[model samples]
Target: MDASELDIVDRPAASARGWRVPLLAFARNPAGSIYGTVVADSVLAVESERQTKLSDLIYAELITVIVYWFAHVYADFLGSPPSGSRRASLHRLAVTLGHEWSLVTASFFPLAAVLLAAAAGASIQTAALAGMWTGVAALVLWGQLAGRRAGRGAVVSFAYGMTAGLFGLALILLRVLLH
Candidate 1:
């Protein structure tokens, strides 16, 4: 079972014993979840000039994003050596890295959407747009979810969501301007 689903009493023992550490790391650091989508957004904004093969675009987007996500996990795990024996340390690493699995999963949705659209004979450009917009939608949804947790009402939550989601646009702008 996933760490998050375990009863609360089990969590401490599980971590102490160096069990799968997904939820613990997530509770500690949520930033890893955005790695894939953020990298994809930056890459697509700067290099999405329509010359690449549709398959290349779809594959490259997902691969680059996932690779970068792994790098983040690696960096995070290494930067701080968690307390415990070698086994426990390794478990801690796994726990920390596993939280970032969400980053890969998040990127997968848009990548698949793009690939499916292109396979269905959509224009490469249109398929790409569909994929990018889908990612933006995901970001906005994350924002709304965060807002609700913070006790914001629906409209205010939407506003916050849009604001957070627009940060993706800024990333795009940075890529376009700087690269």
Candidate 2:
């Protein structure tokens, strides 16, 4: 669903409860987060296997996310009905980019986890693992939020969380199998 489809009442209530409303709203439409987490995790897995430097791994993951974000924005803008004029087209492009900004922001937590772990003197491989796990945790949290937002019960929400987490696990498994 697009941003317009979000439940307007939910945002205000979540904000009143001291929840991070933007993050929760993003969770309510988790395609970007899921895409970002998968991409970041896959990068971490591959870089770790190569024993890449922490800096290089971080750069690679960041660049990858930005590139993918731009690609998504471009595709979305192109797919949308064309505006009448050049200025209007540019404005539409900007709006599409803004709408898709979550794709880049969603990688923040996982990347931060890598940075923090590396700063704490963890090996590059260990830090990458931390990042991967952070991505998995984020996916699970997003899934739970989505399920609850959809009015699902606790058990169903938990199941949703598990289903989302399995994506991360599958990536990890692929890394293992490759190496």
Winning model by lDDT: 2
* Residue-by-residue lDDT tens digits, candidate 1, 70-169: 7877888888856768988888888866766767666765677677888899876667656666667766765665566577899998986687678676
Model 1 poorest 10 in a row by lDDT = 24-33
Each model's TM-score, in the order given?
Answer: 0.69, 0.83
In model 1, the Cα lDDT at residue 142 comes to: 59
Candidate 2 Cα outliers beyond 4 Å, as residue runs: 1-12, 20-22, 25-29, 149-153
**In terms of TM-score, how similar is model 1 to the real structure?**
0.69
**Model 2: ten consecutive residues of lowest lDDT:** 20-29
Q: All candidates: CA RMSD in angstroms?
A: 7.5, 4.0
Residue 117 lDDT in model 2? 96
